[model samples]
Structures are given as structure tokens and as C-alpha cells.
Target: MGSLIPCLDLNLIPDYSIAVTPKSEPKLEPLDEELYFSTPNPISNSDPNPDPNSDVIQEFSPVSDITGEESDVFSQYYRISQLFQSVFARKLPQHSDLTVVDPNSLAIVPQPEETGVSAAVLNYKKHSRSAEMIRVSTLAVEDARYFRNLVRTTRMLYDSLRIFSSLEDESGRTIGKRMRGDLRAASLMKSRGLWLNRDKRIIGSIPGIYVGDVFFFRMELCVIGLHGQPQAGIDYVSASQSSNGEPIATSIVVSGGYEDDEDAGDEIIYTGQGGQDRQLARQCVHQKLEGGNLALERSKYYGIEIRVIRGFKYERSITSKIYVYDGLYRIVDCWFDVGKSGFGVYKYRLVRMADQPEMGSAVLKFAGNLRTKPLAARPSGYLSLDISKGRETLPVLLFNDIDSDQEPLLFEYLPKPVFPPYAFQQLGNNFGCDCVSGCSSGCFCAQRNGGEFPYDRNGILLMGKPLILECGSFCCCPPTCQNRVTQKGVKHRLEVFRSRETGWGVRSLDLIPAGSFICEYTGVVLAREQVALFTMNGDSLVYPSRFPKKWVEWGDLSQVFSEFMRPAYPSIPPLNFAVDVSTMRNVACYFSHSSSPNVMVQYVLYDHLNILYPHLMLFAMENIPPLRELSLDYGVADDWGGKLAICN
Candidate 1:
């Protein structure tokens, strides 16, 4: 009766296919080294499996949105598409024991047997080692020493697994299963052991790890949600599950709380020495986000701040600046740029900041230790402390020796401490704008192009340099405004047009001279020490970074810039710096390739304006053309089609 009942909806049984699974057979021997990296001989496409064009089940009907908004349907399609991709794109056959009856079919099959412990461990360890080796070898660690260490460690673990397997009981089925699982877990732990290289000695594994049945990899990814924080999502894709599967990535919704707050917000409490409310302005973000710390995003985390009453005096003729982390620590001293080029110094000590008499005595003792000069200390300077007198005196000590020029200011130190700038200081406007003091008539701000040139103050250009309005009107936001200020070199080309009575004409152009000074790019200058404390990797460490582009380091100028600057602008001539060839790019420009020619492209030497203030005189090689609308090449063997392949 049940077989006959299906006659009404006979079409429901859609055509599908059963994919055959090969019987498992252990290899006769362990894999050879060559087989580890053997070339994949894929089954030729011409030799298709039986019913290769068919599927094992009816394709799942895509869920349609009855409510037909274009956006809603599109979104539904996207979600369904992703889910379908995840299922069908699996590496191993998605289902087993199924026959293909239809070409275009889909169905939900019972889950396959779990990838047992042995298979999982083997795949996971191989995948893990590959990723680690790739990253370790790519870093500037001199050749592949780091990668070698990883390979060595992996080999050692492989040996351990072999020994553990031999010791297990082959006859006790239950015990054998447990023993294999234990060995798999051990192998995983051994692989992860390399991550602790900074502390662990190469002596041996942590105790009990070899004996234990635990592997941290089994722990599932944990999602943590903090209150008042943005909703977040994290996806951990296993390396085996990805296309190519060579490297797996774990991306997360980086919470804002973990990052440093550039604008010294409520999380940062600035208490004065005497608890007096004096204004203390935090160093600008340009300084905070500089140096090796260039990758740090400042708007997310709370900062501990301790500042010298006058930090520059200790290190320079100017006030010495010391960053006391988090309003609390008298424990660590983070010294930053003292305005004197690259001289940065740091030290640590404990300070007591409390109200009791003991607290004062403790602070005084700490101050005494800090005041102690090194054997090489110059006789010209010393340290001083200012204490707020309450029930107990709170001591505020300087990091370096105070200078005579700054003595009066220290003597005039108020009982109250100056509060650094708060995050909310200007909710109306963004940070860094309060830089230029006062309001003036028609001050309309420097138009970056019109009225007064902003770089005029820095004096890099001798008042004759052309001004471009490219660096936005001063009224723009910081991000946009900074980008405008960084216009330099070929990037600053001006579009000149000729127009007649029709207000437009054939805009015939003229040639520019080689070594011509393009418009000056203007921006702020920061000391190298400041950058060291603030910036992260990937951000430039040059003292005079123009927003996104950092100035090349003097040491690296020849090696790094030579490669980057040569043929950097396809429309312009190549620059002569001694940089690595990896950085050069071939761009298209005017070229009349000739077996022999009158004008030959040659490397031209152009002097860069001092990077400090009023970034001016961005010079690029141009032509002293004897003809009209012609491009000249810097003729050199390297510049001709080899390294400079873009040449004509």
C-alpha cells in the first residue's frame, strides 16, 4: 500500500547519483620524503567517472522571499549561496554510498564517518607546520633559520609519535583506541610548543604533556562579547577547509576597547601632582602613532600617562618629556623623543602615589633612586621633584637633570598638576585642529592653494614654489586634510588648459625641465623618539612622515629609495637612488623606441628639500626638450627594458 501511495506525487523522486567511495587500504610503507611533496596527478578531465554529470540528490529549492523587495531577495540569495557553497565545496566527497541519477541535483545525506583521530592529527600537523614555516621564513630573520627550527621540531614530534605507537597494546581494542588518541593529542601539543620560543628552553616539553591525553587544539573557538561594545563576529577557517588550504586565517570584529585612545578619554585619568586641575595636553597622535608602533590604532584603548613636569630639560635644551603610562604608574618610565633627532632613552622604577606619610617617604626614596645619575652623566644637569602638600606630600620627579633655563618654570610649579588634553576637549571638532591658535578676520584659513601658502612658515621653498589647492581647504576633516597636505613630486601635476573665445581650445602642452621642483608637500614634523614609542609596523618610521608616506630613512635612502623611486612615475624619468629592485614599478609614459635616438633616458639626480617644516620643493627629473611634446628617457643598461622593462 505504501509503494502504491507514492503514485500521486511520483515526480518528487528527482534524479540523482551515488558517488562511490574507494575502499581504504593502508600504504605498504610509511611515505618517502619525495612523496611528501609529490606533484598532484589529477585524473584527466577526459576520463570522467560514471555518471560524472549527475548529482546524488534533488537540488534543494532555494528559499524565496514572498516579500519581494529587491534588497531582501538579494540578501536571501547571498545567504543561501554561501551555505550551498560550504556544503558542495567540501574536499572529500560530501556524501558516501550514493548513485548519481540527475546531472543538476542536490540532497542532504547522512554525515560521513568522523575523520578519525589518526587522520585528523596527520592533516592538522602538516597544515600547521606549513603555515608556521611560511611565516617564519618570510620575516627578516636572516635566511630560513626560524623555519629550520620549526622543521626540526616537527621531525622530533614525528619520532615521538612512532615510539608511542610501538609501546601501545595492539590486542586491547578499547585501550588501543585510547592510546592512539593520546598519541595524537601529544603530537599536536608538541607542534604548538614552538609558539613559546621566547621563554621555553630547547631542553624538553613541559612536564606531563607527554603523559597527558590533552591537546589544546580540541578546544573550540570561544566568542566573547563585552557589554556596551559593538556586536562582533569571528570566523576561524580551518586550513584544510579552504581553497589551496595552504594558509588559514582567523578574522575578528576587533573591539574598539582593546585599542589605544588617541584623544585621552575618560578611561585616562590625569591627576595633578597636588591634585590641582592644570591643563595637560597629550602629545599628538602623529607622535603616538609613529615608529615601530605605526600599526597601533589609538582610538580604542586607555593609556597610562606620566609626564615630566619639563621632560625636554633632562635630554635637550628644551623641556624633557616622559610618558608615565596610565595616570597611575610611577613604576615604568617610557622616554620619548626629546626633539634632538634620534636620542631616545628609557628606564623603570617604582613610585608611590598616595596620601599617607609613608607614601611620601616611599615616593621620596623612589625619586632619590631615579635622581641617581649614571657614571657617564654630564655635570651640567640633574633631576628635581615637585610635591603637593596635603596630609602627605606627593612627589613629582623629573626623569633627567633640570636645566637652568627651565628652573624658574619648575620653581613656579603649582601645587596642582596640569591635566593632559581630554578626549572630549573638542566634541565640536576633531583632534589636532586647535594647533593654530587664535581667530582672525578673512583668516578663512590657508586655502592650501590660494592666499598664503601653508609651507611658507617652514621655509623649505624660497617663496617662488608653486602652490596647489590639492591639500584641501583647512576646513576639511583631519584624514582628508592631511592627505591634501601631502601632495608631492609627480603626484602634484597641474592640469593646464588653453581656451580661446569658445572658452576651450586645443590644450597644447609644454615640456618641463629635468630636476624641476614640483609643488611642496606640507605637513607636521615629529622627532624619531616620539615615533619609536607610538607607531607600529607597516607605518613609516621617518621623523618627517607626510601622513601616509614616511620620508625614507637616511640610512635606507640609498638602498630602499633607489629601487622605489626609479621609474616610480611612468610619465616622468627614473630617479637615481640605491634602493632594492623589488620596489620598482614600470609605468607607461611617452616613448619613441628607436634603434638609435637623439634623446636617451638617463638617471637624473634631484635633491630633496629638507623634510622638517613646510614640506616644499618636491623635485622630479624633467626634460630640457629641444622639441615640442616629447618625453626623454634616462638611458642606462638597467633602465633599458631589463629592470626597467617599461621603457620603449
Candidate 2:
């Protein structure tokens, strides 16, 4: 094929733009094998029964036009036309009488393959066709705009319809299987012992046999892992339903030999309803077979197992149970206490439990390390249970920190959860077991004193930084200090206190003063309960769980306001810092006595040195001294003998 790329100004093109040209036709060696073309244009026929993708176009020749000097532009267009003809010839069979062929026959050139081609090839053809169409539209400047818009609209509509059809099919499938109680759906088609989608088929392995065939999978559900005793089986659920609203299985068979059909025992009836009941039924069936009572002829089985693993006294104990349903209202599993001490090992054999023993009770396994290789012995004392009712149950797993005996609560694995796992919806206290410290961090059973933060007095929690107190730690010591200097400067108003007795007064401080760093206060952030009872604008707020309320809420409000204030800052934005002079220790702790005071707290300046802008005189408290303690009396009387009106 000849090179026919339009001469685009090098300076006008972006880096991603590449010249469109055909590679040079390399000289064929004597030993080179000749290339072959199809005898007929497979893409020309629209046979419905042909290979699903036989008619799909593979490569498209773009019509490159040069819009420049008449001769040069026509020459470029001619070369592009010649190149298109060459590619067409390369992909089509030779004709004995070329002169007899029809001119319109160029439309059907590249023959299709018996099977579909790669997506890459199809995409390339689409882009090439799009480029050709665009070039054709550009012939007339006015026609370019209209044609571009029309093409864009058509492509958009096609994409929208494709997505809409896909969604519609999915909705139909979901609705059709809604009546089934099983949590999983079996694809009408199956492959590789795994589930497949009913609508879209999976593309076969790349560059392998049957590469273009559509593959199907069914939603298969089996017990993935057993947590507790071998006797206590795990719960399984499916969403598929029968026309009469009966639950159906959603999985395919994997493995397991039934020595005798009778050995599997009578079919366990799941009287309960909902997704949970179905799961519980599956668990029950598993436990019955795992336990010797309902013998399993085959030793090995391929299926997901769910069980309740109970941990106490720093060690984990697993229990096995059989899920049984008593109508829709009650669905639970029966626990079989088969004593075994294999941690992390999946056990299949099970034994019956002595009673409906509560799971959280202290129990220890001492025969061998649970992590060691599994034993074939008929281990006794594995706990199991029947699903009594409801889709959930308070976790029977107990966690006790060795540092502090306080028990940590964990929720059991509910196959048919009321809500999808980790949804963070609803206020239910039953959060799944602490997956953070469990699987990810690796369970350190012997760590910590409840694994929580501690707090200090004064309602201040220091976190991520250090704090220092100049004065010695004050724990209700009598105040005693002298020679305290409290001075307010004209330019930078400052208050200096000289204490001799206690710390901040005039008695103990000496004249020759050299500053020295005080001991640092090192502590972590306080517990949420430390300041549970605080007021924001006099509206009481409480700590909810481990997070703070009100104060943090106000901080958030300030931050949002600051965002809007950015454009108007220094002109309309209000100042951020507000010093509270009500308290003597606070810089803004100024006091006054007046029913109708003239002064009020207002934005002063961005800098700390500047006082309140447009300074409003203070109505100072009565008997105020130069060095005496300053206190703000909120409920003081004015000279007119009226009570001060406090806003909040």
C-alpha cells in the first residue's frame, strides 16, 4: 500500500498525532512463503447462521484528503485512493477477468474469518472507517459541522441503547430469580466448576482453542471455610426461586462420594424462610454428613464450609453445628461439641454436642497445636447448633485480652446478612468481627489492656505533639505568688505575671530572670468520654461512641465558611481567631458589669498584636487592679442598676 497521509503542519499537531501511511512493501526473499487471501468476501454475506462474527469488518482504509494547493491536494487524494485499492486487493482473491468486475464490488473486499477476530482488530477498523467518513464530510466546510454533529449523535445513541439493553436484561434476570430463596444463582450454562453470568458470555482464553466462543457460568454457593466445630455446620443461602416461591439450589456439584445414598440420611427440611433459612439449611446438611451420625462414604469433598470459631483465654476453640429450620420464624444451626485442637486446619469429621451449651463459655484444647498437621482421629467435643430464627445472631465468639480480662465482643459470620457486609448502614451494634486486627494485622491474642486510649484532667487531650507547663503540676495547691507584673502595652498589649509563692504572683519570682524550658507533657489523645459533657454556644453536646460532637461540628462549620471567605478575605471575610478573656488565664478574658454594655467581642485583625478593630471601650469590672487577678463577671450590674443581658 502507498503512503497517503495528509500533509498536516508539524507545528499545529499534538504529540499524540501520528502520520497515517502504509509501511514499505519489503522485498520477498526466494525462500519467503507467499501470503494467501480468502476466495470469497465472507463479510459480503449477512447469513444469520454464519459464524457469529464472520461478517464483522476487520481493517478499514481511511480516505486521507489534503486541503491545500489544487494539484498537490489532488495528488495526495489520488495516492490515498491507490493505497485503499492496494489493501483491498491484498485481502481479496484474484479475478481472471478484472475488467469484467463491477466497480461497486470494492465495497466488499476483506473477507471475514470463520471465527471472530480480536477486539483490537475490530477497533482498528472502526477508527479507520470513522476517519474516512470524517474526511468525506470535510469536503464542504459548511457540511463538515452538520456531518460531525450527526455522526456524534448517532454514535452516542448507539452506545446509550447498548447500555440500556444490557441493564434491561440484567433487571429481567434478577426479577425472574427473585422468588428463589438461595443467595446465589446458577448460570443456565456451566464451565470449569464455577458460576457464570446468564446474559453475557465470557470470552475464551486468548490465542487458545475456541477463543471466540461465549462462555457461561452459574452462581455457585458452597461453604468456603469452616470456623467452629466440625459438627456445627455453616449457613448457606441462595436467591433463586421456583414459580411457586420455593427456594432452589444455585450451585453445581464439585466432589464427594456417597458410599450409600441412605448413608446421607433423610433430607433435612428447612421450614424457615428468607435468605438466612436457606443458608442455615445448607450448613445443617453439611454438619450432618461431616458428623458420623449421617455418614459420608467418601472421605474428601469440595465445598465451602462455615462454622463458629469461639476464642477465649487467649486461645481459639472451634465448634461444628447442623443448621435446621423450624418454619420461617425460626432458623438456626445445632452445635456439635467434638473436642479437637487443630487451629487453622479445616476438619471434616464431626460429633454431636452434649447439650445446647452456650458458646462463650471458657474452653481450652490441649492435645496438640491447632496449627500442626491434622489428625484422622474421631475428635470429640466440637460444638454445633441449629438455626433457631432470624437472619442474624449475637456473635458467640468471645475475645478476652490477657492484659485486662475485659472481654471483647465479636459478631458471628452470618451467611444471609440483614445488610450487605461493611455497608455501614443502620445503628445495629453487631459489627462484623474486627476484620482490621484479625485477617489483615494478624490476630495477636495476647496483646493490650482492652486496646483503648486514656485521658487526663482539664478536659485537654494531647495527640501527635508535646505540651509543657512552666508552673509545676498543680493539683489543688494553695495559690501563693507575689511581685506579679501584669502590664498592657500601648503598641503590643502584654500581661506579665510575677509570682513568688504559688507560681504566678509577686512573692517567689526574683529580678534576675533567665528563661528555661519546663518539663514536657507527653500524652496521647484523650478518650471521647473525657469531655462528654461540654457546651457549644450553651447547647449541651455529648460524645457518641469514640467520636466527638458539637465542638468538632462547629470547627467543621468554621472551615466551610473559610472556604467561601477566601475570595473576600481582608475585605469581607470575618477574622478567625477569637480569644476568650472571660477566664483570667485567657488573653481575651476581659470582664465588665453593664445591663446595656457599649462594647462587644468582634473581629480585630489577622495578626495577634492588633486589638479589636474599631476598638470599643471595655466596661471593666469594679475594683480592678493593675496586678490583681482579672475575672469576667457575666451577670454583673451596671451603674444604672440593671442586670447585664447575656445573649447565651
Question: Best by TM-score, which number?
Answer: 1
Query: lDDT score of model 2?
Result: 0.19
> Can you write out model 1's per-residue Cα lDDT over 146-179, one digit (the tens) per residue?
3333432332333222222222222121111222
Q: For candidate 2, write residues 1-648 as lDDT tens digits.
A: 122232221112233333221211111111111111222322322221222111122232222221222232212122222332333333332322122123434433223332333311232121110111000111343343343333222222222222222322332322111111111111100111121111111111101111011111101111111111111122211111112111111111111112111111112211111111121222112122221111111111211111222211222111111111111111123223321221111123222122322221111121122113112221422121111112222111111112232111111222121211222223432222233212211111101101111011111111101111111111111112110011111111112122232122110011111010111111111222322322244522211121111111110111111221111111212222221211111112212223322112111111111221211112111111112222222333334223212211
lDDT of each: 0.21, 0.19
Q: What's the lDDT for residue 185 in model 1? A: 25
Error of 2 at 544 (Å): 21
Candidate 2, after superposition: displacement of residue 304 in Å?
18
* Structural similarity to truth (TM-score) of each candidate: 0.17, 0.14
How many backbone clashes can be found in candidate 1? Answer: 61
Q: Show model 1 residue runs off by greater than 4 Å.
A: 1-111, 115-123, 127-473, 478-648
Strongest candidate by lDDT: 1
